[model samples]
Target: MGCTDSKDNLTPEELAIMNGELSLMYQAYQASDVDLVYRKYSNDGIININQWQNVSSKLKLAAYSAPMPPKIQKFYDSLKAENKYKLRDLLVIGIYLSTGKSIDKARLLFEAYDENDAKVLSKGDIQQMTSFIVEVAVEKTCVLIQDDDPNNVQPEEMAKFLQKLRTVKNKGKQELCKMFLGGNPALTELTMEKFVENVTMPSTVQLLTFQGVRKFIKKQEVTASKFAALTSLKKPTGPSDPKAELPKAK
Candidate 1:
């Protein structure tokens, strides 16, 4: 005889109760009421609550599955092999800043000195990077809110989020530094690769594959070159050339 399935052995009444409990648990999850959800399910019972928890977590990930913009995708495609690590760091920094998370703690990931004795990104450097991220986020958010359909994000909601973002930005670099660094000053410094491993979230890491850091670097380079070219152009300090006189002075 074939082995019997335990689920098949449940009586009609038992099956009905199990289904009802599941339904109630799902409702609680949708409402984000963890206490109610746990009350309806037994963690130490035969119901396999861990499986249901995993399903709920996956559903939450689905909401942030918005695709990156085409421009960002192209930038990511253009990055050289060596710059991949930099791109990863950029993504982590972007995610933290966008989520209003602290970066001071992340600074512990940098080394005090490289092989050449040059220092890596200091706390001040991190603060500057955060400011740059906040500016870029503000610009992107502004464009997103102007769209007829901004990836299912409502205009009012986006406006409110932006307000919160600006509030964080206005806290100034020192406050931002303190928030991330905390009271502890002693922490082991890791390389960029190690740092990426610690900070990259599996569910959201794909969002950064669009070359966010590369795009920012490219934009800065273009702006700098344009400024240099404009500065190099010498303005005329004398009157118009005689050869180009205006119609014999009319």
Candidate 2:
């Protein structure tokens, strides 16, 4: 469980690459420049984490959905903890422009950080991001899944779903990802309505402890026997498939 070193402890070579370089990282991600972001973070092996780990495929999707170097760099401190705890301040900056649901969750999560204020996630944020992310994943996975059996994902669960998709071999996971995306807990009827019908609401509920979901996914297929064993009880479906898989490990 020991970590290597904090970003502060990085050598001059590393520091030159990462210090106060968030905007550069964001630009790299926006342009979908994998190599640039990779060079930036390949310097740091830190795996950004969150509750979405319960489903492996979901997490993988988020990482590859775009170059998330800024998100990775910002969440560096919090996601590095040996235990499961969220870094609210870190999430706000990266997720604000992420998507609407993500923005909403980020707002609520940020509010929780500022518990005295009782702030919440915004409606407009969720709708926009959902539309953008889903449109992308559906387009990518639909073509890939049929031809090469790639990850078919819906936007709502994209973040949570991809976070966990990185654990094992991407091959087997591809075969089972449809079930994963299909089994997605789904945005609530009310939440889905907002993005679908463009209804408006003031704020939405954001679960605090629920952020640990990704941690749960890493353990889903502890072993092949257990993987099959667990299913004996209720005929478990394979792990959830994120819309896409991460190029990096979570």
Among all candidates shown, the one with the greatest TM-score: 1
TM-score of 2: 0.20
Candidate 1 accuracy as TM-score: 0.28
Candidate 2: tens digits of C-alpha lDDT, residues 74-102: 43333346743333322332332222343
Deviation from native of the Cα of residue 107 in model 1, angstroms: 7.3
Regions of candidate 2 where Cα sits further than 4 Å from its true position: 1-93, 96-188, 192-214, 223-227, 230-250
Each prediction's TM-score against the native? Answer: 0.28, 0.20
Worst 10 residues of 2 by lDDT: 204-213
Q: lDDT per prediction?
A: 0.35, 0.30
Error of 2 at 115 (Å): 28
For residues 1-59, write the lDDT of model 1, one tens digit per residue. 01112555533322332232232122223222332232244233212324334433543
In model 2, state the lDDT of residue 139. Answer: 22
Candidate 1, residue 106: CA error in Å? 4.0
